[model samples]
Target: MSTSWRIRIMLTIHAKLVEAMLAQAHKDHPFEICGVIAGPEKSNLPLRLIPMRNAAQSETFFKFDPQEQLQVWREMEARGEEPIVIYHSHTHTPAYPSRTDVQYASQPQSHYVIVPTDPAYGEEIRSFRILDGMVTEERIRMINSYKAEWELSMEAMVA
Candidate 1:
C-alpha cells in the first residue's frame, strides 16, 4: 500500500451546507452526481468553503456548469480565493480516478477529491493529484487549527 503525503490545503468548509449536500447525494442513489467546490487560497492553498452547487443530471455522468464555475472562480479571486480545486463524487465506484477522469481534468495544480459512496465502503474518501493524465494519491491531513466540514470533502474520509 502507498503511504499518503500531507497537503497543506487551505480549506473552505460550510458546516450545514456540506452535510446537506452529502445527505442529498446519499438520497440520490445509483446514478452518479456532481457538484462544485470553491474557497480561498494562499500560495495556492485553499482556505474557505464558498459554496457547492449541483451538477446537471446526465445519463452516465454528471457535468458541471463551466460558465457558472468560472464565475465562481472569478468571485473567489475577487475575494482572494481563486480556483484551487474541483471536487465531485463517485456514487458506486472506488475513490480512484478512472480513465475518463484522467482525460477530462483541466486543473493540474488543484486537488481532485473523489467520494466513494459504495455501500460497502461508504466512509472511504480519497484525494489525488492528476496532471497531464497521470494520477497520484495525496494524503489529506487535518490541521489542528482548521475547521472541517460538518461531513467530509471526499478527500478527508479517504485520508
Candidate 2:
C-alpha cells in the first residue's frame, strides 16, 4: 500500500484572544509583555492566555522569568497542554521579530506572534513559523470556533 499524505498547517485565533493580548500589551506599554496561548498537546487550538513576567522588563526585549517559566511549563504538562502561541510585544517598532527574537525562538511548531504596542499600527499582528533559523509568515484566521471550520472542511471533502 502506497500511503501518501499531505501536511496541512492551519493557523487560527479567536478575536477575543487577540483583544486580550492587545490589552495586555497596552497595559504593559514600553516594557514589553510576553505570554503564551496554550492548548492540548499537539493541538493547534489556542484557548488560554498566560501572561508571563518579563524578567528583563525592558522596552527593547522580553525574557520570561525562569522560575515562572518552569512553573508554567509544569502546569501545562499537568493539563495535557503545550504552547500553541508564544507572543511578545514590540513597544517602539513594528510588530515583527527582531534579530535576537529569531535567534531565541525555541519552539519550531508554536506560532511566534508579535504585537506592537506603539498604537501607530492599530490592530496589527503578525505570526511566523521559525524552523531551523528560517522564518515563514503565516496568515491568521480569526474564527469563532475551530470545530465549525473542521466540520466545513469535512463537508467539502465528502462532497
Candidate 3:
C-alpha cells in the first residue's frame, strides 16, 4: 500500500478584490460571471482585476468571449503580467468546481476561484487549483490591501 500526502495550498488576495467579485456575482444573479486577475509574471499576486463578459451567458457554465480573452492576454503580455487568478460564479450550486470546469481549465498556474450566488450557499467563496483533471481546494488569505515590494521600500525610505 502506498500513502501519498499532498501539501495544502493557500491563495493570498486582497479583500477588496473578493468583495468586487462577490458584488459582480450578485449582480449577475442567475447567469454566471467570469473574469481574470492579472499580476506580474510568476508573482502569483492577483493585482489587476478584469471582469470579462461570459460568452455562454449561462447559469451553470462560463466561457469568456474569445475576442475579449485575446485582447486581455495581449495586454497582459505587453504589461509583463499573466493571469494569476481565473474566477467565475455559480448561480445555484456551491462554490466548487464542476466536472466541466476541470475539463476546461487550461492555465495550470492560475488559482481558480468560484463564488456561489445562491442564497442557500451564503457568502462562502472557494479557491482551487485544477491541473491534469485533479482539483485541489486551496485556503484563501484575504488581506485588506496588498502593497508591492517597491511600495514597501518607498514607505521604509519615507519612514
Best by TM-score: 3
Best by lDDT: 3
Q: Can you list the residue pairs that collide in candidate 2?
A: none
TM-score, each model? 0.67, 0.86, 0.87
Candidate order by lDDT, decreasing, is: 3, 2, 1
Report the alpha-carbon TM-score of model 3 versus the true structure. Answer: 0.87
Which of 2 and 3 is the better model by TM-score?
3
For residues 13-63, what per-residue lDDT tens digits would candidate 3 score against the true structure?
A: 898999999999888878999999998775567889999999998999999
Residue 100 C-alpha lDDT in model 2: 87
What is candidate 1's local distance difference test score? 0.57
Please give the distance, in angstroms, between residue 28's alpha carbon in candidate 2 and its true position after superposition. 0.7
In the range 1-159, model 1's lDDT, one tens digit per residue, is 211222333333333434544565666655555554545443334455444444656424556677767777678778766555556667766768878778888877677766666767566556687889888887654343333342233344355
Please provide, for model 2 over 1-159, each residue's C-alpha lDDT reduced to its tens digit, 9 standing for 90 to 100.
111111125468888889999999989888999999998765567888899999999999999999999999999999999999999999988887788899999988799999988877655888888888888888888877678654444544455
- Per-model C-alpha lDDT, please? 0.57, 0.83, 0.86
